[model samples]
Target: MGNVILRYINLMVVTLLILSFFSFSLAYLFPGHPIENLTGIRLENISQIENTEFNYSSGESLLVQYWHYMGSLFDGNWGVSFNSGLPLYDEITNVLPASIELSAYALFISIFVGIPLGFLAAMKHHKLTDYSLLSISVLGYSIPVFWLALLVILIFSLQLGWFPLSGRISLYYEIPDITGFIMLDIFLSDIDNKEAAINNVIRHSILPTFSIALVTTTLIIRITRRSVIETMNTEFIHAAYARGLSGRQVLVQHGIRNALMPIFPLLAMQFTTLLTNAMIVETIFSWPGIGNWLIQAIYHQDYPAIRAGMLAVSALVVIFTMSIDLTIRLMDPKRRRLKRAAI
Candidate 1:
């Protein structure tokens, strides 16, 4: 296991280096540099354009500049935002919790709702209930996130006036930032109406969370249903039934556990997917998250911020996925046996 982990870490390192280089190159090659965005001036004459003030390392070549950029990254400096003149690292950290909170909530909703629905569908396989859920899942997965988000906002915020239109929380309640998550912050705050504050946060979060989780939940349902059905058809499940075990007992004890083993790694991958999709959801909901921040950085052609954002997100995905893979191996006895045999 140790050797396997080491090998995976080595692979992650190589992959990150490749990802960083390409991402850095793409940011650098963007049509308008940060200088243009900051000064509202374009250098039409390439030959005459020297890095006099913008700090492109005027005396050094492109390779040297990139080398210095990589060095700075290692030194925990992501440079400054072209528009705000603040450190890119600070900006990323400041906005990261919003994205994390949003993604985590969406995943929680997906798992809790999806797994049981999937189990029921599998239990009632080839029946009307199964077909109905399958259809719903398919439709949910097919609907575009941005469109769904907008539609929900229209119904809930505009037409119905049930929820707020945009923003994380109402400006009326100034919840102190305890954990960077508004809900948690509200919970932690010394407010007169603690329950009301938390409820407000939940109400504000519902549309965006639901919209983002719709597709993810459907996908989970589909995967889980298929896995459970496959497990049910296996000989071990039949053997458990032969032992005079109740159907529910067999399913709860043996079937669901076996079925869910394959789903963990997939869940890990979904974390990154949710994070990427948050870019659109956050924009639509006007939620303050790293994804929205990155969009603004791109619009302003903040190359340093762009590069840093991409690398940070990529690193997070890679590390998280690898950790899940390791967890999956540890959780499944069959995987442990295989690893032992391979070793």
Candidate 2:
């Protein structure tokens, strides 16, 4: 176990280095300096930019520049944004919570809603419920995220007025930045309007959450349906049924647990996918998250911001990937040992 942990840690370190290298390369790989591109004036003098540090200069070689960049990562001197003049690391930190909060909610919805629908579809194989769920999953997966965002905004926000159109929380309640997560902050703070704050936060979150959740839920449905259907045909599932377990009991006790073994990787991949889709969803809804921040950085051609955002996002992807693998392995010790033996 210790050896396995060390191996994964080493792998994660190498992955982070590689990702950071590509992310940091944006400074040279991009056509022009962000300031130059934004101002339509060539930066003959790097000193003109106020209160900022450049990672490298034209005088330095690529390897030397990367060395400085890596040093800055450990030294906590990631430089400031050309567009905002804020520390790039701090800026990434601020936006990450919103992205995490949104992704968390979306994932919750995907699993809670999708898994059951999938199981029902499998259980009802040739029935109307099965066909209906399949169609819904198809439509959900097929639609573009931006279009889904707009459509939901139109219906729920504009037409029905059930949820807010954009943002993480209502302006009516100013939750403090205790934990960076708005809803969680609201709960922690003695704001005096905890119920209202909670309610408003949830209401504001519904539309954007739904927009992203629908796509992931559809994927979960298909995957779950396939996994469960196959498990249903297996000898273990048949034995459970023959042991006089009720239909629901057999599916719930024997089927769902076994079916989930194949779904761990999908969960990890879907989490990353949710982050990618968030770039689109955040823009359409004007949500103040990393995706929206990254879009703004792009428009201004803020290389520092771009580099920081990409590295931050990439690190998150790698972390979640590793974490999920650890979690699934812990859930099934035999499978973990088998993999270790094979390796």
Candidate 3:
């Protein structure tokens, strides 16, 4: 077990370094002197990342320059944006919670709603219910996220007037920044009206959330339908039925438990994809998030912010996926046996 965990940690470190290097290398894709041109800030400003100045002396190789760049980026010594001239890290951290809050809500909706819909479809196999869901999933799989987001905005935000078109919350709700997450902040605030503030957050969230959730939910539905069907056919499920267990008990107690295990890693991987879609969704809706910040950095060609954003987002996804792998290993009975064998 310890060895498995150690190996996973070691791999995560290697992946993070590789990802950081890849982000660092993006500077070299263009003209000369990558660091000086890309950072846009004085070298001395970035030097305190390690409290050691990096001249990137003429004699030094590209690798050495990368080391200094990586150190600065990883440690938040990314200096400032070329356009806004704000510390790159502070800017990113400020908007990160918005992205996280949106992503969390999207994922939560997909999992809770998708799993049940999937099982319902599976149980109704060959019926209209199953075909309808499968058809919807197929459509979801095909539609581009950006287009779908736009369409939803057109309908919900514009035509029907059910939700706001953009922004995290209405300008009027001066929610305190207690947790950085607007919904929570609204609750933490001593505002004149808490419900209205939260209502604004939810209203703004609905369209974007629906856009993100549609694709993920469709995927979950497909996977869960397959997994649950396979679980239902297994001999153990038959034995449970023979032992007089109800359909609900068999599914809720035994079927779902085994069926869900295989999908845990898949869910983690999907989360990375979710973040990727979030970048586009954030930009489309003008939602304040790391994605929107990154998009602005790209538009203005703020290389420091771009580099920092890439590294930050890559690290976030890699770390999350690796952590999920470790958790899955810890929980899996088959993996436990493998660990014992290795021991």
Candidate 4:
């Protein structure tokens, strides 16, 4: 166990380092002068550009600039955002909670709906239920996120008037500053006014959450169905049935566990993909999240914000991947043994 933990930590560190390097390289590749754009103080003379103290001045070498950037990162200075006139960290903190909340809700929907549906489909293989689920899964995967989000808005918000069209909360409600997560803050706030706060959060979250959930649900169902079907056909599954195990016992104890093992890794990758996909949804809904912030930063050539956002997203991906790997290693004896030997 100790060896496995150490190996996991080492892998996480290496993955984070690689992601950091990649982010830095990508940021460096961003066209235009970041410092000038951020400061809004342009130098007409090339000599002035060279003489500026704020510019990369450790040395005129590329290696020196790379080291300087890394050093700045270590010092907790991610740079300044041109658009908001705030530090990159502050801007990220302001928007990150919303994105995290949206993603978490979407993932919850995916896991809850997808797993049971997939299990049913697998159990009823070659029957009407399976076919119907497979068709829905295919359609779900086929539709683009932005289009789906729009369609959802049209139906739920405009047509039925069942949910709010955009934003994280209603403008009328005054929420006390707490955790920044609306749902959590609502629950944590004064109990007498909780109903209004809860209603405000649910009302605002319904549409965007549904839109994101739909996309994730489709992906999860497909992966889960495939994994379950494959697990069902394994020799051990048949052996379990031969041993007079109850259908429910075999399905839950053996089948679902094995099926879900493979799904965990995909979940991590999907999370990162979801972050990128959320950009269009956030824009359409006018949600104050990192996705919309990133789009605006790109449009305005706000290099600092863009770089910071990209790095933050990359870091999240790396962290999620490392977590998934460690989880798999801990759960799977074979993986744990391999990791131990490698260590």
What is candidate 3's lDDT per residue for 250-337, written digit by digit as tens? Answer: 9889988888888777888888878888888999999999999898888887887887888888888888888987899789977655
C-alpha RMSD (angstroms) for model 4: 2.6
Worst 10 residues of 1 by lDDT: 32-41
Residue 159 of model 2 has an lDDT of 97
lDDT of 1 at 229: 94
Off by over 4 Å in 1: 32-64, 337-343
What's the CA error at residue 30 for candidate 3, in Å?
3.1
RMSD of 2: 3.1
Candidate 1 per-residue C-alpha lDDT over 274-296 given as tens digits, one digit per residue, 9 for 90 to 100: 88888789988889998898888
TM-score of 1: 0.89
List RMSD in Å for every model shown.
Answer: 3.2, 3.1, 3.9, 2.6
Q: What is the per-residue lDDT of model 2 for residues 1-343, given as tens digits with 9 covering 90 to 100?
A: 7776776788788998899888777666778664443233455665755423342433467787678778878877776888878788788888989998899999999999998898889999989999999999999899999998999899888999888888877777777888788887877898898998888888888888889999999999999999988989999888988899998899778888888888776787898888888878989888889999999998987777777888888899998888787667667766567655542
lDDT of 4 by residue, 60-102 (tens): 5657766777788877788887777788887887788889888
Candidate 2 weakest ten by summed lDDT: 50-59
List runs of model 2 lying over 4 Å from the truth.
33-58, 242-246, 338-343
Report how far off residue 71 is in candidate 1 (Å): 2.7
Location of the lowest summed lDDT over 10 successive residues in candidate 4: 53-62
Q: Which run of 10 residues does model 3 get worst, by summed lDDT?
A: 49-58
Cα lDDT over the full model 1: 0.83
Clashes (candidate 2): 0
